[model samples]
Target chain A: MNSLSLSIIGFGNVGRGVAEVLYTKMPHFKKKYGINIKVVSITDTSATIWDQEAINLREAIETKNHFGSLKFWGNEYEVYKLDPMEVVKEIDADVIIDVTNDKNASKWHLEALKRGKGVVTSNKPPVVFDYKELVDLANSKNLPYLFEATVMAGTPIINLLKEEILADSVKRISGVFNGTTTFILTSIETGMTFKEALKQAQTAGIAERDPSNDLKGIDAAYKATILHHLAFYPIDFKEVHIEGIENLSEEEIREAKKEGTPFRLVATVEEGKVEIKPKKVYENGPLAVSGTSNVAVIETDLLGELMLKGSGAGIKETASGVVGDIIRAAVSIYKYL
Target chain B: MNSLSLSIIGFGNVGRGVAEVLYTKMPHFKKKYGINIKVVSITDTSATIWDQEAINLREAIETKNHFGSLKFWGNEYEVYKLDPMEVVKEIDADVIIDVTNDKNASKWHLEALKRGKGVVTSNKPPVVFDYKELVDLANSKNLPYLFEATVMAGTPIINLLKEEILADSVKRISGVFNGTTTFILTSIETGMTFKEALKQAQTAGIAERDPSNDLKGIDAAYKATILHHLAFYPIDFKEVHIEGIENLSEEEIREAKKEGTPFRLVATVEEGKVEIKPKKVYENGPLAVSGTSNVAVIETDLLGELMLKGSGAGIKETASGVVGDIIRAAVSIYKYL
Candidate 1:
């Protein structure tokens, strides 16, 4: 049986989550998918741990959880303070799993694809900002550059669009793309101040410490831009019109509620235009997703309207998507007799 | 660029719809997917037209719609008065698309798979009754056996479950699998008697001429059985417990409505059990899909709960799903370098 080697970049929550899933689901993956996955290298901002032989993933996970870095590894491992590009160039791996939130990681992804390595990532920068270049590079190389966790986490929006609905022409896509903004908006709808809702979301780990991208519609814009590129057109991220929830007033929310519409931060891509704005939606409409849930309503000529709803963000959810993409990439590699 | 060949095994509404899609989406498929798909053979109950150089799909669709048969073609095709198995064995094609309602089509599917041809189907019997055998044969031969239209038409449930959510453990699946029954049930809810609702559904073409399968819960049971096999356990169709709306009186429906619960023909599969019963669901619950819409609520351990909703049945919708599966099969064949 052939085994696939994986080098993970950024051992953060998503990276460790993939490691945990790969560790726990090893037997199932080998038994069912007939593909063995080995973590050969794992790199973070501080250190990069590489081993020609498979790394001790369990100890590495524990080391990262305890010491917050890969520095606690024993001397048996070769540790180097290498950047993402250096590791991408040097790693002897079949696939590069990019879970880094670094904005500059798109260069590393392109480098990896150019090196004939399959790329699976939960990172949004490469896909949202550099979709055409990365996708063209991957297509030119006949490699898989999958990012199922980038939009809607493990909800499988990208896979659904590309693989399942391949023959249908998607006319428009509108949905709740940002979970943090949706959480805040839903909390505000329940009579909480915007500040209180934001604090609660941050306390619940839904919002990050530096949550400018999430709060100011940049995150939603990135998702909308990615979806637009995949579904309809290859509209750039900067080209998408964006409006955050900061300008939405409580009086407007109350007024909309009285008129039978509820406020929701919706990301819409249609007719060569993409935008993320806080709009009033009908109460029972598909876009009126509450809480931290995300939903995408895709309109197609053949399939009419299709809606997919699921948990937008979680460690296990995003990891499930990334690992699923790993299996898909592996299957694509070994599909033939 | 290898072009794939298809042999369709029906010329009814769905078959014509598939031809229409193939004719219109040919350029899109060639440009986007980089594959050419040709309909090599088309068979109906009356006649079989086999053309080695590929049939004029537009003309075939026009013939089916205008004259209702392939008799209009004057000797440009090989016409035979043969059974489906003969056609399956004789047709030199890469894939067999079964869109017939023939109960004995499973034998033809088995023969086609045994002959090493990929099978894409909208027909349900072959999947409902002989899923294990057909799937095992396809797997043993490494050929594709896709039936995305069998359960939810163009909704992409099967792909979502098998491919996208492959890494997650699907705990349970509950859904409204039969669109005709749902349409009838919704009609009954809107101040119509059971017979009146069934008549209305038949008049609206939502219910078939012989709607026993739709009314007696057989359709939902078959879908539940298929979903159970795909999601959890491979429970046989006979093993699934079924309860139809024929037994539920108008008084019971009114009583349930008074109690704030709406009657829905829910197909539920959980913990080694599958059942399609007329249960009273909450007004706005996940399983409360109105009219002809189909919704599947999949409970997975990793991604928590996921819901997918779309049009469950239509000529173009089901054809879109079948064509999508055909593209998927073609892509799988061409994935490896």
Candidate 2:
């Protein structure tokens, strides 16, 4: 109960951030939750560094940073060519931290839960598609399956709603869910053309090489679906009505800005619907957060309007969420055991 | 394990709010937390209503509404002429909910903890004065003594920070803690004089009869002490430097408003210090919240700044927080038992 082990299923930037954060806040977690989290297995797509006797996260991070990957850090014998499936199935750990940031990690999440290990995921597909099934499995086993970083990275929409679970029912939830689109839209409001805004967003690392996912509202829709499931009811991903910001004309953006109701990619989750579309945000309401800051308005029956705002993206910011869920998972394990 | 009995020590507005919220959310809590919270005993200042079985909270609320008090609702045999102390000492309950907003309930909180009963409180005296001693005693007995409403009244500042505990170190916590003062300041920013603004606030029922506690910054300083203890270290009530807004000049307020940095009575909790004063809030940041909204900016090492904003005043809102803690206490008691 003093310590719990984890298998980090991805060794990318987010995985490294999680390691660095746990390294820095190990004492804090131990003091607060009375549990220390240890990463027993670290995995990249190709290879993994596994140690039953907890891996030194700092060393693993350094090895990855210095050697480019854990794949190249250790000798062929030390770094096994094990994929996420094998690692999730065989690793002796209390929780599986899925930071793969891809749909491919969805199966690994279910496998970890099936093996009676808790799961803390930053990945979205597992939650988007299997929201009820995954939660039911975890609950049946008295384990915690959390996806705090799926919707708003470290902004704590999911975690806050969990605390709001027993107290009240969520009437409606609306927010600016994706930071990339928010950045691009914000840049366009500053008189930049859509093309110039997208280019600047790419240059600033805010948009990906292929940013269609963000521009098409796919990312925001996924988050909206996850929130809809948590707050209201489980919904089909395809049922979400999505209209992306890619169609926003520069003239329309300027007109909206002139009217003081700047365009934002708003995601709304109601009783049985999830919608993501570019619309004019409230001039002075909770949805008026500027920059890449994410903001959510939860309309509850008891507490009228609750606003949560924070950074929606960034490695350390996201790791703040994953690490928070990691502690919750470990505490759950310790308490149950 | 399926039911948790409670002793509600105050039957005022907030107390009735808690009862009504619990009554409305009974099915929700029973379904979510797998526990039914029953009010075994309820007490106002002058009289007590004792029921070994669950009391109908809606009926009690109706009784209070129909009559001036619970004093005339039940028969003499049903309602005893007992005060808070007698009820707290002899009540058969699992948790004691103290909504008595006074210094006298301080001793009742300690006595409840001494009797091994978990406490969910909206009262501030126990937290602002004897935080460490009360929390230490609760923890020493593996009981949860949560005071979520004592600071922001269901704003979830304390709850959110508890989730953020293991994730990052809180560098500083700054917020608009007093809603009455916030309402007054916001009114003054609309070109009203201080006297006129205070009168407006009083007419709106936002300010109390003797509003010195809020005008003198005493309430904000109390909240600052609680936040400092939760985020940084335990601090003395006298340690917080306070400044009242009663001395604010209409000219100075207008100047600050004209400068675009609106005046707000901000409460800040940093390492080893808590400060409350009427200062200019950032025009674009989290503290820019208007009206009577309670907003807190938590500067964390990992996630930058996390902002939580909600209604700082209201009955149902405060009950949302107190009921949240009651469910948490019930879950803890169920798990430990």
Candidate 3:
């Protein structure tokens, strides 16, 4: 069994986390599933590293820790400071994991699919931008283009809705699809100002440096668009109505609470239409119960209603999702190749 | 793009319901996923029916409704009252669905694997009896021997544990795996005696005619054995200390409620051992929240704890599981074959 070689396109928090999980759990994963996974190449805007016969992950980790790039990790491996597209073609990889923040990485992903190489991504921008084209490319090539870590970090909502719970008809899909906005909204519900809540979310490592996307519901809207597309129901990103937590006032939050309801930034798709907005929901509603913890409630005809709730974002959780996609892709490889 | 040819081994309630779902959903499944699923043969202890083209599902339904046996449908192709093993070899089926009540069908399933045919079953007997052998045979043959309907009807517990929630070392698997006991116990909690509860459960289609297995906790024990095996843990049925909902006094039930807990017959596996017995759980606990509905809570090292709750047993729900497995098997066929 040849090891499934992986080339990571980014070296950010999640990309490094995937490397760490693969390194730490490689022995266990091999022992259990007969999967010999190797992160053979890595590329970032700053630098690139490539080793055909498995790079020394320990050295890479240490180099990243010390000099912040693998370019100065000595002549043990082929190194470059080229663009990601150049690295994608040069690296002898079976799969290209697009973790770059570039919104146009989705195009690269499609190109990879066209080149007959599988694409697994954690980047949300690509999926939120051109999910249909990506899906079509994957389907055309009979290759898997999985983004398990995109929407809800570790939660298997995509697989759950797509494969397992094949609902005859999906009536509604509603949830807290954004962790940053959820955290900020939760803080605001607990009497914090919008700026104070955003700061708290940032301090908690839940929000980005520029918290505009988190505050304006754009992140959640993107997630909802991707989810709706995967559900086989295409809804335009612009058509997905957005209402952010930035406008919620202390008085409004208090008033909603007083009326036996809670203010939650909810993203929903019902009857093919998408709605990504903050709405006051009563205690009986599923979104009301989902506070800081992210929850996805899928209402279907056959399965009736199913709710999946858990930590939506983190290194461990996001890495778990990526690793899961890796395993699923491995299973497909085992079956197909 | 060959149509999925199916052979149902038991023409019971679940079998008929599965037929209904297939008959209704085949067009949609074919149009969406390009899977033309057709039940080619059906067998019961009383009679058997086979048609190479496709069985007249409407006529079979009418026969089952009128004569309570599929015999009255008249043989358009081939029909017989043969053993399940004979059907396994004789029928030109891509998949054999064993919904038989026999606890020893595991052997038949293994034989099917030997013949290079896929098996989807709702019967828990084979899995509970010898899981390792069945799993190994299926793996060796590169065939799917799925029993998603075995543990929790339509809850997707097995798939949820296996594929969706990729747990890093599942710490414990516990749930109300038996619906009859749950229903009886719930009735007892609602001011009914054990005998009255059992009677009501039978009337409500929750309990079987021979309810000894459920009342004595053996049914739940079987499910626990299967679950433990699926989790890749070595747990023998004999090692699972069984204690059912039998012989519980009304005072015990009342006392349980008084302490803000409820008496639930739980099948639990921890540290590689199995324990099936009734336990008192707090109101916030999964078991407490799961009333007559079946619930399974899986605690893993990475994913923390996850709970899946839904209707435990019913013709429709159990049939939903069978159909879900069918769809999955179809997808697998598309990928692998």
User: TM-scores of all models?
Assistant: 0.95, 0.96, 0.92
Q: Tell me the TM-score of candidate 2's A chain.
A: 0.96
Candidate with top DockQ is: 1
* lDDT of model 2, residue B123: 93
Candidate 2 structure lDDT? 0.85
Which of 2 and 3 is the better model by lDDT?
2
In candidate 3, position A327 carries an lDDT of: 75
Q: Write the per-residue lDDT of candidate 3 for residues B157-211, one digit (tens) a residue.
A: 8887777755266788878887777677667777888889888878877788889
List the pairs of residues colliding in candidate 3: none
Is model 3 an incorrect, acceptable, medium or high docking prediction? acceptable
**Number of clashes in every candidate structure?**
0, 0, 0
Each predicted complex: what DockQ? Answer: 0.79, 0.65, 0.42
Native contacts retained, all candidates in order: 0.84, 0.68, 0.22
> RMSD (Cα, Å) of candidate 3?
2.7
Question: Could you tell me the lDDT of residue B226 within candidate 1?
Answer: 84
- Order the candidates by TM-score, highest first: 2, 1, 3
Displacement of residue B62 (Cα, Å) in model 3 is 1.7
lDDT of 1 by residue, A1-337 (tens): 8878889998999999999998998898888888888888999888999887888889999989988889777766778887788889987888999998988888999889988898999999888888899999998988989999999999999899887887799899999988898888778777888888889999999999888898889998988888988887687676789899888887787678677798888888897899889899998788878777899999999999999999889899999899999998888776531
lDDT of 3 by residue, A62-124 (tens): 777788876777765667776788766666777888877787886678778877778888888
lDDT of 3 at A41: 85
